[model samples]
Structures are given as structure tokens and as C-alpha cells.
Target: MITEPARGSTVTQTIDNDTADMSDVEAGAFADYVPSSELQKVLTEAVSLLGGSERPGQVAMAAAVEQSLRSDGKLAVQAGTGTGKSLGYLLPALLYCLHEDARVVISTATLALQNQIITKDAPLAVEAVKNVTDSELRVEVLKGWQNYVCLHKLNGGYEGSEDDLFSTMEDSLAPGAGGGGEAASGRGTKTARQMRGFAAETKKLYEWARETTTGDRDEAPRGISARAWRQVSLSSLECVGEKCPFRSECFQVSARDKAAQAQVVVTNHAMIGLEAAGKQNPLPPCEAIIVDEAHELDERVRSQASTEFSANMLATCAKAAGNLGVSGSEELSQQAIMLGVALQNLEDSRLTQMPEAVAECRTLALPPLKAALTELSAKSGSDAGSDGEKHADAAKTAVAKAALTSLLDTLETMTPESVANGETILWLSRGRDGDQEPRLYTAPLDVAGKLANRLWSEHAIIATSATLKLGGTFAPLIHKMGLQLEEPQPETLDVGSPFRHDRQGILYLARDLPAPTRGEHPEVFWDRLVELVEASGGGALGLFSSRKMAERAGEVLRERTDLSIMVQGEDSMAALVNDMREDTSACLMGTLSLWQGVDLPGNTCRLVLIDRIPFPVPSDPVIEARCAAVKRAGGSDFMEVSLTHAALLLAQGTGRLLRSAADRGVVAVLDSRLATARYGGFLRASLPPLWPTEDAQVVLDALRRLHQKVS
Candidate 1:
């Protein structure tokens, strides 16, 4: 174990003992080793340039990351908030790329984090590396094809189709036009106003698309909605590839080209997951992968690996086949109807085995789908010959072929034999309304095996996050990631936060409050919540487990007091957070996303109110299936699946307080479970070591004092 030194102190510990054993290996095995002094010097210069002070945890983390990259080993780091984790990993990644002349891929979970690394962190690291090594290093951002505007779609290529952006805008401008549906006979004024807004935003996007060189959606005007962007962009399956006249100047291709030429490539977790699923290798080959928000990797990979089948999906495939002049298009459409009927008859639950009716529909549909795909593939390959019509036909055929190929792959995965084999989990999910259709979904029961085979075996991995180790240890996450089975098992490190949690914050456990029931909290819970907000004079962040509870709390607080209250769905998250930051007396209430996504520093956020322990709903199909698997293996499902989920979220929620060294606050858990339940100790260990108190008045007094100080 490596112990991090005190704040502003230099780290003296070497790499872990296991790494020391491999220090004398052959030349080519670990060739890109950079001395620890060089890493520290680069980090020091980067910190100086960024106008930040030195922290021992950041120095320790940088050394650990460097050791992992140098030994070609795996590591998981838990660097708490205020540790400067981005620079900790970036400096080493940049140094490795400079020394070895090999590419390194850095993946993050969110677009905000990806943009932060590229725009803020990477450039400073590059400069630091250049200052030390006297060599320029290149870095590029690579995203999915849909993230950029499609030239073919932006032009008049799909002019007559439902995908045409200009046609959609024109329709929106028509009187009584309801966007997708036909004009309502007497549409209300509100509907008309909304359509006009959509039209205006779409027009702005169109004008911006014409002038932007990169075509990246992130660079476009801010007001555009996702629905408008879809009209101008293309999904991977919708792209015509080399058959299009705009192939050479394609933005997605250009981004990939730049990434290929760079030494460090920044991408997202979903892209890495897609490559692991054998869908497509969207990333450049790299010597190592540093997953920065590492806690979200497993769930993100499962999302990418999951497949869904719906009537609308099949109907769209049929329409694409019809566009390509495939003969069996009608048959495929009929099968889609049959599949929808079969799914309607079934309840929404995880399947122990595939139903006969569903299996029959899938089996009957495969042949015609395959035939249509074959014909489309042939047409897609035929020469366009210098004629404009022929070229358009070729491009359309290519896109249709890709769509059919994707449909075929989904159908094969849903085959009865595949479902019965115990390798996949199949379930049926319905939309929120009764009128909406139910869809069949399948995902790998476990992604550990896939990640181990496809990712860990190929590259050195450093997975770092603020919440990687739940319940006081890394074993759970390590086992979940399948790193326990690796040849050279991953090393673990916990470079503690720079903030003095005990001195800066309090963990207030409401021991007298009743254990929360399933639906609504008791009246007493609301009373206590109001009291806390009043005590703090309202710089509070309310973290709820459900939207209903969050909204109800907002209503109660808004009625009970005069402070400004903001709910999650009332406005954009960015707007809500900004409002909270600007007005120190405002309260922002939201659900799961607010737990880890927000970073509100200073006196603006002085209280974090947690409604209860955030446990996964037992009725969720994936949770049910995973719990069953764990129980069958003779393990406690509560500890493995349920408790860990709650613990991780609890840690993340607790972290919302004390964002900086000077910040002070109280993380008040309104539920008594964290103080009286059997698992309380485990959950408490996962959080920052704050001063704990059970007396409500003690916390109220502390909050009042902090409020007075800030006021």
C-alpha cells in the first residue's frame, strides 16, 4: 500500500511492490518509462501555468498513473474531489505519448468532461510536456459519427425524404402543422407557437451548418434541440459511406483522420464500449486507455451492448428496404406486425425463456430480412458511373443496406436458442403510456468477460474516479470489472481529498426520523426538511431518489418559506445550476443526475439534503435479473448488488458538499437507516470522513452559524 503524504508535501514512496518486480524486464516490454522526477516537474509546471497550488494527493496520483503506464499494468485510482485528477492522469498520458511515439486513448463518461479535458486540461499538459521534453505532442477529440453534421443530409441529398431538414422546417412553418403529424383541423395557439419556435431554431442550425468548418454539433448555436439536429445528421447505420459525393470532406471521417495522426486521442465511454461489442472500432489503436469517470464504465458498456426490437424499428427497416427496391419488403413488414402482437400479449418482465409466439415471429422474419439485405448489398455495390441519378441511387442503397444489416444482427441475437443459453438476459419494456408499444430488449448478463477479453488484454488501463471504491474498498468494483481474473492484477490507490472534511463539513444522520416508506414521506419528514432549509437560510441542494419526491419537497419548501426554489424539470439543468450558483439563498432540487453531475463551490451551496438511501428499485428488470444471478451463486445479493449501488450513490451525494478547501456545509441524510440499520457502518465508511452527529439541533446550530458567517 502507498500512503499519500500531507498537503503541500512531496511524495517519497516508490511504485507498489508488484511493479518493482517488473522493473528489470526486457527492453521492449516496458520501453516508455519516464522517471518520477520528470513527471513531478511536468506536473509542477502545469499546476503553475493553471494558477493552482500543489497538493500531495495529486502528486501521488500522478506517480501511480505513471507507474501503471510504465509497467504495462492495470490500476484503479480513487482521487477524491479537489485532488486535481485530470492533471494527474493527463500529464502521464501526454508524457507516454511523447516518449514512445504511440497513441494513448483517454475516455470520459460525459460530453462536459470530454470538452473540459480537450479545452482546458490537455493543452496545459501538452505545453508542460513540451517545456520538459522539447517536443510538440498532438491531441484530438473523436466522437460518434452522429455528433457531426452529415454533408449529404445538409445538402439537398435527402430532399424528398422524411429526413430532410429544410422540408421539416417548411412543414413547421405551415399553419396548424404539428411537426410530425398532419395539420390539426384547428390547432390551438400554443401548438402553433411551439412549431414556430422549432422552425426558428432549425433555421439557425441550418445557417450555422453552412459556415462551420468542423460541422461538430458542440460548436453549433446553443438553442438547437436534439430533434432538429437529427434532421441534419446521420446515425452510423444511416451513413452511405464511400458512395456519397461528400465522402472526402466528411466531418466524422476528418475527425477520425486527425485522431489517427495525433499521439493522444480523447473519446467517450460509449465509443470504447461499441468497439468492445464488435460493432465497429471507432477509436485509433492505442497502447493504453485511461478511463476518467471510471465508475460509469460498466453501466455505459452494458448500454452499448444492449439491443432492442420494436414495431417502429422494424417498420423503419421495411421502409428502407422498399426504398432500395428489395422484393421481400412487404413480408418483412408483415412479420413486424406479428412481432408487435406477440409482444403486446406478454407482460413486462425478465424472461426465463423466450416465448414460442415471439420466437416464431423472429424465425419467420429472418429469411425475408436476409434476402432483402442481400439484394440491397448488391445494389449498393453497383457503379454510379458519372451520372447524378445513378450516384444518388447508389448512396441510398448503401444506407438501406446498413440499416438492414443492423436489423439482421438484432434478430439473430433474439433467436430462441440464444435466449435459452443463459448468456443473455431478455426482457420486455413498455413506454410510460398505455397507448405506446412494448419493446423486446436483450443485454449481456455480464460485461466483465467481454471487457476482459476485448479491452484489458490489449492495453494498459488506468481507471480513475472520485467514487471508484465503495464501502471502504476497491474489491467490489475490481470484481465487477473482471480485473481480478487478469494475469497481473490491477493495483489500487486512494489519494485522499485535499479538503479537510472533518473540519469543513458535518454528516448529520437523522436517527429519530422514521424509516421512509415506499411512496410518500411522512408529514414529519417534510417538517424536518423545512427546518433544515430555514436554518441554512437557503443555499441548499436537495437530492431525492425519485422525481415525485423531489417535486413534492420543492412545493413544500416553496409554500413554507420565501426563498427561491428550482426543480429539475422546470428548466434546463445548466440554467438551474447557474441560478443556484448566482443566488446564494436559492435551493436547487433534483434526482439522480444531480448527485454526481453538479459541482457548486463557495458559499453558494452550504447544505446538501439527501431524502433517503438511494437503492435501486427491486422491480427493475436488470436489477431483478442480476439479483437472481447473485443469489444462485450462493452470494448475498443485497451486499453485492443493492448495497453497493446505494453506497456509491451515497458517496457521490455526500461529495456534493465541500467542493473547495474553504467551503463548509452539512450533508443531512433525512432517513434514519444510515444510523440504525445493520448496513449503516458500511455505507458511512464509503463517504468522506466528516464529523458525524445524531442530534438535529447540533446540525441546525452548525448550519445557522455557517449561514451567519457567510451572510
Candidate 2:
């Protein structure tokens, strides 16, 4: 068994080739590996399909993938913008899988990437690879159950008084912008089919999906609601596996089984976190795991492993338990009632606060659960009970006891001193799914520790992503994932970018601009923004860190110019993309959703506007705890980690400027920190090598010149 190294002991290798030691690695170990000319042809085809030219970064990514497969040692490659990093990695991964017959799992940060891979990129790459590889490589996309619509929940409807609640939801969703029953566009154009019974539609599609060759969600002609998807979904902890009535034909199970049989599997970070934590074993063990948009891995892991208890969930569980036969008996049933009432009383009292409620819930909950378990155990062992009766009694007792004990233990471990001074939380809540039950719970700020301990320790794991590096190095990132660097120096390489950032784009910082106050409107910034947009001639993307900010900016732009302004939350992401693509002189103002994963080459997005540096909220429980934890551990959490995390995200944000060698644009960041702060240099270094300037006119002129060239 391999033991994890002591914290802060691992060192990351410098990007330069000046000091790397070649003694440990064989010089020609990968000499037999040659870049497939056929794979190169496919990449060329992809570039042509997008009407863009390939850059150096894309070429290097392709090379790195080819080499990493042969060596099998861990490899991290940073491919800057226009690298076609997705296709770069895809080409080699496909070629190698075909040759070695090894399964490969490709994981990404967002649903957008997963969609692209399953719907667009994967198919395109496969079509190109098929011409040369002489073998068909099977690929599939697997997501958490909650992402799919549930046939049972949709058809059966909800159990309680959800009829009225669901009726309101249905009515609200019925009419779109154009007075149509379907989700309509501004012009009254409906984007999809009319609403149907969620369970029936979900199950029908799921059944049809089984018979179809590709199980991609994009195959569905109409869009589905996120809320509707949650009804039929099951997470790792909630899944009962083979015992499920739909086990033989389960969509999730079939997806996993197919992944095991296929050569390549496309999945997301949350599922990967579960896989890394050994929570659910879906895909077969593979030689490598490729993580796309890798920067979000830490946060994604935290989200999946963390537990959330609402006042509602607790109340529902209490009510559900009461309805169960456990409370049908005389004495134990009375104890169960007392237990539920006490829990509810606590929830109603000073326990409205999450921390206090978590503490009190543990105290009130354990004793009753223990008493009920004792009673149930006694009944199960009685001579008067039949075999089936005994089994049922025992099963109920075991589940209640196990769940109560686990929750109690978790709450007890989450002390204010531990959480407030660290990066974890023990949250208490008061709400359930369309019911009035409340629950109490605790969760961790980071799931890397759990994941590393449970899965990576015993497995030869491969985690890959495009935007993993934040501050020129991977040190800040690996720490969040609960993995330390190996030896005094860990391997590092920048295969170099295919796109010429210095030539294709410029980075403009809005220095001397006043910081935004809480109540301020866009009027203060709109004058300068209009001038910039006019200079760019409307081919721009304004990215705001907040949705409120994005909407305000959109309002101002709408009032100021003839340019088309499409803001997020105004419509679906698909609608926004379509609008941006149709009009060359259009501006798309959006929040974090458009920060990364947006791909538009040439004139469509010639100017990128960053409203602010995306920073984790100071009052956020997880971020606050993590910062304090770093401080307690004898480190400066702000400068050492948090800022670095922000820088990486900023890099990802700025990278949206250029997607091909011929793609030219100016990335304008409203935050002065990219120019003024002492740490500004650090953030700038993380971005592509763009020519930095503070002159607004210069940036405007550049945008004009670029737009003219494209037009």
C-alpha cells in the first residue's frame, strides 16, 4: 500500500527545460511512439470545419497525449487558447485506445463540455479517426441520475400535497415570452415540444435511448427542466443498486455497463470525484483519466461529497418514519412520536441557526433512534414473529440505526472551532422536497481528502483538464484535491500554445476606474462601455462575475446602442448562443456561465469584457473556513491559495478571447487589479502572453482594426 506524503513537502518542476533532470526517465522510452499522420489529418479537418486555423498549443497537446499514453507516468500539460486542446487530447486518446485496447475516461468541469463531447466533439473526432484507425471506438456519456428526468416521479406525481405546488409550476412554465404554451422566444417562436407528463416522457426517452446507438441527451428534440430532472435521479448514497425494480433496464446502470465495454467514456468531475472516492464504481479501471477544464475539480469534489440537511428533509424523514410500521406498535410508536416532536421543537427554537440546530439535533435525535432500534430488535428476535416478519423488522431497525448514527457522528465532529477556524461546515436546515419537514446536517468545504484517501490511494489514477493551472504551477490545485506532489520536484511542462496571443489579441486593463458600490447602477460605467462597444462594432462578450451586474450592464447596453444585447437568464444558454452567432454586431452580457466553455472564433466575439475578477465570496462558509484553516496551519491563506485560485479562474475567463490562430480580439478587464494591485503581476502571468495596455483608445483602435479585417 502506498502512503501519502507529508503536506507541503512536494515540489513542482519549473516550466523551463533549463533545470529538468533526465536521469530518472529513459530518453527513448517513447521513441517508438510516432504521431499518427491520420490523426493530424482529422485535426486539420476540425480546424476547417470551424473555419479556423490550428495554433501551436493544439499541436503540442496532441503530442503530449501521444507521449503520455506510452509512458504511463502521470503527465500535466497546459495548452493555452486556440490549442484546440479538446481535439488535441481526443485524437491521441482515440488512437491509443484503438491500438492498446485500453479503456479511457474523459472527465470535464462543466455540463457544456460534457455536452460538446457527447454531442459535437466526440462525434466529429470519431468520424475523423475512423478514416485512419481502421477500428470503431465506442464512446458514451454518463451523468448523475438526477440530471435525467425520472419516469416514476413524473408519472406517479408527488406523494404529498404537491398537486397545488406542481400546478403553479406547470402554469408558470406553460407560457413563454410569446404567449405560447411551449418555452417561446422573444418572437413567439417555441424552441421545443409542449410539456408532457415528466415521468412518461423521461421513461419513454430512456427506453428509446436503450434501443438507440448513442445515449446522448442532445438527441432529445426538446429541452428539459433541471427541477424536473431531479425527480427521478439518485445519487451515490441514495442508490440501492441491483435491488431496484428497474435494475435490469436501469439507464444509469446500462450507461455504466456500456462505459465498461467501450474504449472511451465521457463524464463530469462530480462523478469522477465519486469514482476517485470509490463511492460508486461505474467505469472499469483504466490507465488514464483525462480531466477537461480541470481548474474546477476541487470545488466540484467539495460539492459532491458535502452533505446538506434542510429543516424540510428532517421533517419529512420524521413524518415518513412515523408512517412506517415502526410506529404502528404501541410502546415504541409512542417513543417514535416523542422523538419526532422533540426534533421539530428543536428546529423551531434557537436552532434556526444552522450550527446550533446541528448540535441540538444530534442530542435530540440519537436517544429516540436508539430506543426504537432496541424495541425493533427485540420484536425481530421474538418467538411469535414469522421469518419474513423478523427480517422486515430487522431491516427497518438497521436502516434507521445506521442513518441516525452516521448523522449524529458527523454533527458531533463538526465543531464551530473546527469549522469556523477551518474549511468545513456543519449546516442545519428546515425544509424538504415540496413538504414542510426540516433536517439538520454537516458538510466539508473540500472533498479532496476523502477522495484521495478512498480512491486514488489504491488506484493508478489519471486526472486531466485544460484549465488546471492557476499561477504558472499546479501546486495550488493539487493541494485542494488532497494530493501532494511527489519527491522534491514534480514533473511539469507547457507544450506551448498553438495560438499566438501576443499577435492575435491584446489585454486591456481599466486603470483608475472607480470600484463598484452595492447600490450603483450601470450608468456610471455605461458611457465608457458604449464607446468601447462602438469601437469593437458590437462583436463582443461582456462577462460579469454576478448575474445582477450582468443584467444591469445589459440594460445599459440596450438603451445606449443599436447592438443586440442578449443577457443570461433572459433565455436558455442555447438561445443566447444562437443569438450571438446570428448577429455579428451583437453583444452578449452574461455572468459566470459564460466565463468559460464559450467557443466562438473569428469576428463573432472580437472583444471580450470582464466585469470583475471572479472571487469566492468572503462570507461563504466553505471559503472562509478554508482561509482560516490555512492561517492556523501557519500560512497566508489569502495570498498563498485563495488569490491563486482566483488567478486560475481569471486565466480561464480571459482565454475566451482567441480560439484559432486567425481569431483576433482584445480582452478588456474592468478590474484595475490586473494593472494596479501588487499581485496583479501574478494574475497577468497566468494569462496568455498578450500585450498589456491601460490606454482605452489603443484597445478601441485594435478592436476596430481586427473587426475590419474579419469583415
Give the number of the best model, judged by TM-score. Answer: 1
Please give the range of 10 consecutive residues that has the lowest summed lDDT in model 1: 11-20
lDDT by residue (tens digit), candidate 1, 1-711: 112233322111111011212111122322242338888789889988988776777777788888889889999999888888999998988888778777899999998889998999889999998998898899899998889998988996755455211112323323334544333533555667888998998999999999999999999998789878976887766677776789899998999999999999999999988877888767988999999898888889889888877766666677777766887779878987888788878998889799898888778778888998778777767775665776677656655666667778888876677677666789987754434467788988788888888999889999999888888999888887777778878988887777667667778889899999897999999999999999999999999999999999999999999999999999989889999999999999999999986989988898999999999999887788889889989999999999998998999899999787777889999989999998998999899877677778767877887777778
Q: Superposing all C-alpha atoms, what RMSD in Å does each candidate have to the true structure?
A: 7.3, 10.6
Instruction: Report the error of model 1 at residue 351, Å.
Output: 2.0
Can you write out model 2's per-residue Cα lDDT over 282-363, one digit (the tens) per residue?
6567766776776687777777666544333333334434544454224333433554454565532212134553445545
Give me candidate 2's TM-score against the actual structure: 0.74
Cand. 1 Cα-lDDT: 0.82
Question: Candidate 1: which stretches are off by over 4 Å?
Answer: 1-35, 161-194, 384-386
Q: Estimated TM-score per prediction?
A: 0.91, 0.74
Task: Tell me how far the alpha carbon of residue 32 in candidate 2 is from the true structure, in angstroms, after superposition.
Answer: 14
What local lDDT score does residue 357 receive in model 1, on the 0 to 100 scale?
83
Please report the candidate that would top lDDT against the real structure. Answer: 1
